[model samples]
Target: MNRTAPRPSSLACDECRKKHLKCDSTTPPCTRCTNESLLCSYTPSRRGYRRRKTPWDSAKTAAAQKTPQHGGTSTSSFVLGDMDLNQSLPLKPGDTTPPAPSGSGIVPSDAAVFSAEAPTDTPQTIATNRSVELTRQEEERLVHLYYTHFHATAPILVPRKRYATQAYPAHLKAVVHFIGSHYTPAFDSNLLHDAVEVLLSPPQESTLHTTQALLLLSIAQHARAYHVNALATLSRATEMAIELQLHSRDAPVRYGGLDPLLQESVKRTWWEVYCIEGYLAAVHRQPSFRCNSVSLEALLPCEENAYRDGLEEPQSITLDQYDARFFADHSVAFSSACYRIEAIRILARVLALTAATVDGPDDIQSVDNAIVAWKLHLPDDKATAIDRCGDVDQMMLQAFAFMHTATVFLHFPRSELLLRVPTATDIECASAMVPASPTSAQHATKAIVASKELSDLAALPVNKYSPVFTCALVFGCIVQLSACSAHAHSCIVQHRDRVALMTGALKSLRRHWPVAGQALRKLNTIASGIFNPAQSKQSGTSSPTTHDSGIGMDATMGDLCWFDLFPPRNGTEDFTMFGTAHDIWPS
Candidate 1:
């Protein structure tokens, strides 16, 4: 075979590059390449060639090339206040008539322009209407209720500025009223649904205002048992965040080109979507959207004050760094908002992997490590206190509850999964027998512990994270009760405490979330069986008791809504989508 002699070149040969070896700048074949009979080629010098641009780079370039709209100004330069009066119309859902005049009726000339803009009213137009139904004082009250209750955690709405003359979108105002009313007795269920209908008309180009309004609307819908609409609204919110590229690291640099505060708000909005989607997935028992730690390039939100004060150069840290210390330590390095965001990020990761059945021991270990690290470095002052009932304090407490809930969720198997396995040892007697392995028992123990911790926290007022924590805490309590039943003789010490904790948590949760009410009823039925063994069987199985006493017909029987111990009769609804209003809460 003929061998080519090596020639000197500026670049390494393909063979050397593949081997990760020092190249002698050989052109024909390096000595190793020639000796090994391998193909050796150098990349040609590129005096004329241009490097390919990435999709993001192209997007940036295209954005730069676009002409300024509404004069020689970028889109970011336009504030909510600068919107044209001709665009205002407050159409109701499904109403075709031109919407009722927003705020003050548009001036005659502006009215003609509005008519020219659209002769016929559509749902989108209704969303943009600035008609102020509430008086200034009433509006201020509603706004106060919102800021007092939700603004801290959600923080989607912009802060009110003194002497500013901006027209707030009708849908945005409706959403605020809807959410604020939930905590107050002034609003009923209809008010919440009506608020959602405002945003449901149609999504309008995913502006920051629209996204914030839609997100809050989704939460309200979710709380109102409108799960399908909640999911749909959330999907739209997520799309808006993505369209804005809030997921990218340079999102601040790109989207915040002019207003850094707007950029920070965008980051929080994206993560808020991230957190919501994750919890929604767990509740729906489906695969989560792809907003994991790896895919997330944006920074975890800075402190609330930082965003509010419009700090010139907002400092930020990655979720990993936040988890490492920023979230756990409070030495002015992090905020409650950051803690909430980070907690959800972790929960999202755990739920995403576990739902897909892709989580292995290492993944579980990673979650455990993060939780342990957080607990180890948790600030002493920020600890969960029973007396702290303020909104911010309650949020702090709820964050801790969510962390525990995530732990229980990670380790606990779904009821359907367990039901299908059909262990020879009865579930009612699970504590009597040793688990298949030590690891399994360890997981169960950890889950029970987390559940108790969450239950303890549920003693306080419900926070937004309450719904998720409520479900997890109840599940944990049931598991603990079952264990006590299984080992009746050995687990006597904490049996009363476990029962009280489960009942208390359920009662507390029911006061705020309707779903908790259903869980409470089911728990009461199960509790009846476990506590009153004389009237039933020692094992709390669905099997009918023997009725050894042989009751007379004179005794009046009470109504009992038996919880179906069996898994779903059909596959249409399983443990995955178990919590929806239609499905009813499963065991």
Candidate 2:
């Protein structure tokens, strides 16, 4: 039978038809109609035969009609009529029925729905937990990467030996070369971070020996970082070194007989670690932990143990032995000097801070006493001790001079100290030990021993290649001399000319001296300029002329010149020389 096709359902509004692809048809004002531009119409429909209520529906209706077993009572009765299309649904005979709702908006019964479905046998709890754990592990890995690579490079100095067979070592070496060659004040932060990272992440396949080398590089980089207070970086480096040392000790069969190069690298690493630890401790005003003893013990097999007998003697070893390379070979010297300097600096800072805090006589005396003791113990000939140990004999003289000058300044003001030691003049003499300026070729050709010594020092790994360390040495010496000269001027009017001479000499050395040349030329120029300006004038380069004209051919001549230039102010009188001819002469 070809029954008439059902009229195509009319589209409702565009939105509903587009979304559901359903049709609605009701006349205007019809039950489905709306005044808003919604389509409203209903096609004449052939209705399906209505069936009797299903067993579930009959049960649900009966349940709704029955009184609740609980104390609660139904407020309204369910009305039975033409089986409601939304409610009449078939169900199995044994199904426990849910009570029919009295009105629309009734909440679904979860228990009834669960009862209708069979209980599942499997559970997903374990899978859920595993997913969570995996997520956490991933997050932790991300954090580790952020710290080790993003914030700062791990300060892991992988040794060249570790990468001997691989290109990674070469890449790392190149990286270091780039950093060292191009390092500037602006690049310090970034370079430091990269250096630390390279140190921390040596290739996994690297041998223990190579790893130790890389560690050394890391330590050196960290030491450089210390100049700018990258304390956390330095601390990490030290920790890494300690860990590597421990690992090496435990695996002697594999790493026990490390080559001298590795051994030296390890020693230097510990030395720097110890130094940085001490410095950081002192800066924080905490008692520095004694890493020196531990380091010394670790390095004993590799070191000469030169000062074992005099370990208890303060300042027994002169500063001349404190070269950076010495630490590479002789770890004891390195640790000792590192500890000593740290202690000195810390104590000095404490005294200064304390003096500033309290103005009483006792505080001043306490500081003064401490200063005196420090001066007495300062190593002579040891201004740059790490570099001078090789020539202990020659270094001893410089060490002595340094100690004497340090002693004078430690007790007196800068001016009074200058009068006594006049190290600025000595610095000029010391400068003669360096290469002469290009402008002074004639002086450069001079074969002075001091010049040779300075040249040797410049070539040494301890001072020559390390610009940071060298700058520290130069500035330290200048500060000591300047302080002495300043105090000397404050204490004695008669010593004013001597102070001026020292000041002029220091100024000349700092301004004119270059590290490339021998010391003799520098000394000759400085001495001539200070002792005999007329001679310097004849030589073409003007002596650093001073306001106080207390330097000339003789002490008497200088004194007369001083008076002529600076006539006594108010009640002050011109300073007069009172020594024999030799006493008045420049040494």
Per-residue CA lDDT of model 1 for 231-349, tens digit only, reads 55666666666666678887765644555665676677777777776666655544445445337778877666656666577567776776456444345456666666666667766
Distance (Å) between predicted and true CA of 56, model 2? Answer: 79
What would the per-residue lDDT of candidate 2 be over residues 478-511, giving only the tens digit for each residue? 2232232233345334233333333333333322
lDDT of 1: 0.52
Off by over 4 Å in 2: 1-175, 178-229, 244-254, 257-268, 275-290, 293-295, 301-463, 478-484, 487-587
Clashing pairs in 1: 91-126, 102-131, 103-131
Candidate 2: Cα lDDT at 459: 29
TM-score of each: 0.62, 0.30
Clashes of each: 3, 67
Residue 497 alpha-carbon offset, candidate 1, angstroms: 4.0
lDDT of each: 0.52, 0.30
